[model samples]
Target: MLYSIWRYRHFILASIRGDLKGRFARSRLGAFWFILHPLAQSLIFSIVLAEVMRTRMPNIDSQAAYPIYLLSGMAAWGLFSEILTRSIGIFIEQASAMKKIAFPRLCLPVIVWGSALINHVLLLLAIAVIFLFFGHYPGFAWLYLIPGMLLISIMAFGIGVFLGILNVFARDVAQFMTVFLQLWFWFTPIVYLKSVVPEKFQFLIGLNPMTPLVGLYQDALLFNQRPEWMNLWPAIVVGFVAVVVSFMVFRRASPELVDAL
Candidate 1:
């Protein structure tokens, strides 16, 4: 599958280009809208929550720090959740193409990841600029964003492909994910500080794999601290397993998917 995808590398890039161009084809701002929409959201949310949670961060001493914290987490969560959400409907969206095409089916999820990564790049760039505008430069700690986003993206892609395969067979899987994501968001601590999550309920947050990943982003981007590497290993192991399992599932199910559609 790896070799096959490489064989058609140009096709994948073209598909990504076409997908992006079509997405922005009708809008005046086009791709800028992607960055603006999320930028505006982070700015608005930060303004609202800064006073409430500004002091939660120990490394940063200013109220303006809240959006930096928030957007850092969003940078990670947005890539993850967007890929997962889009994965649910991907097979269905390309059902006709699946039936007719002889290309690798794995490319479908890759396309999703690639597309989300494009948007993620924009968001990260926006976040960096915002940090600069606020006089909060990241320095050396900022480099963590690359590997941090990679690990998160790989893990998210694994979950997405697994869910996508399931959604293909059970249409309800797609519908259920919509509601599942809403609940998942509050649980992940995107807008607020985890320190504010009460001790009694902290165990619930600990059980969430995303908790540590998002924390990694927050520590690196918001506080300019090294990520809690001790806590990150377990999540990395889970991501590896998920990627392996997803590949096995996709390989076994690909031939049958065309029939199902």
Candidate 2:
């Protein structure tokens, strides 16, 4: 699979380029919309929830504390959601081409992954500028975003491919994922600080693999602190297992994928 994907590396890049062009062909703002949408979400959430959560936020002394924290979490969540959601639907969305074309089927997901990384890079750059405006700089800790994004992409792709194959057969998996992701987002402590959760409910948050990942992001962007590596082991273990298992399942199911679609 890896060799086949590499054999068609140009196809993947060209598909990504075409996708970007087609998506923005009708819009005036074009690529700027990618940065604007997430920034706007962070701004709106900060405005509406900042006062209520301000007292709860700790360790950060800046007036822009809530916005910084929200943006950090959003950045991580944005990439994860974009990759997972797009992956789940890609097989179905490209069913026609898959039927007619002779290209490596894995390229569909790779295209989505590539496009998502581009959007993520743009969002990070925009967030960096925002950090400058707020007089908060992550400095050396900014390097953490690299591993953080890679971890997120791996986990999202794994789970997405597992479900995307199922969705091909069941169809309902797509509908179910829509609600699941929304609930997943709220449960991950993106909008509210984890410190604010009740002690009893804190255990629930701890059960979520994303909790620590988001905290890793918050530590880097909001506090300019190194992540508590001890806390990340569970997510790392889970992500690794998910990727392995999902690939195994995809390999077994690939022969039937075209028929299902």
Candidate 3:
């Protein structure tokens, strides 16, 4: 782990700059669009659902600021989903560089995930501004969100690296991930709350690694409450296990990645 981390530092640094520039190189708005995309989505969804459709999902409290609640959940979900989706093509997309330069294969996924996380942090800053304007103070409990965000990022990176390597061999992996992420998003609590789920279904929801993650963000940032540690601990354990397994899989497959490409 240490060796890979050390070897990949340059790739990480380069990828960050490359990814950022590649994303906005041709665009007039450049990096501003990164912040604008999420903010615009949050605003449009919040207004359309809360006003036009009046579509209030069952789990969240009726009196609660629904937009704030929804955006908090969406912020975490968006980062994970975006990273996983983009990481699917990392190796294939960077095949030229991979053949010419020997670098840690793991850095591919890390860079993709890191770029998306930077966008998420920007959105969180926007969320903080909105909260302040509304006279809602998140208090010290908001610190709990950092661990939750880290766990989500780790899980996303692990899964992304694993799938990324597989996608090198299987052209269908990216297509499958598209559908998988869509299903996973709805299965998660982004559009609904855990309390609204039926008792029997609640256990199943808890089994989802993303459940506790989204719950943690909403609890800490929106409700100004500490994360439910008992529930969160299981997700953290699962995330760590996922990371170890993914590392082994990616390492084992690294030798064949270029060949597969």
Best-fitting candidate, scored by TM-score: 2
CA lDDT of every candidate: 0.85, 0.89, 0.79
Best candidate, lDDT: 2
lDDT of 3: 0.79
Task: State the lDDT of candidate 2 residue by residue for 125-220, as single tens digits.
Answer: 989998998888758998987888888888888888888888899999999999999999999999998877889999899998888888889889
lDDT of 1 by residue, 123-155 (tens): 788788888888888678878778788888888
What are the runs in model 1 whose C-alpha is more than 4 Å off?
A: none
Q: What's model 3's lDDT at 8?
A: 73
Residue 237's lDDT within candidate 2 is 86
Candidate 1 residue pairs that clash: none
User: Candidate 1 — worst ten consecutive residues by lDDT sum?
Assistant: 55-64
User: Relative to the unseen true structure, what is the C-alpha lDDT of residue 91 in candidate 2, on a scale of 0 to 100?
Assistant: 94
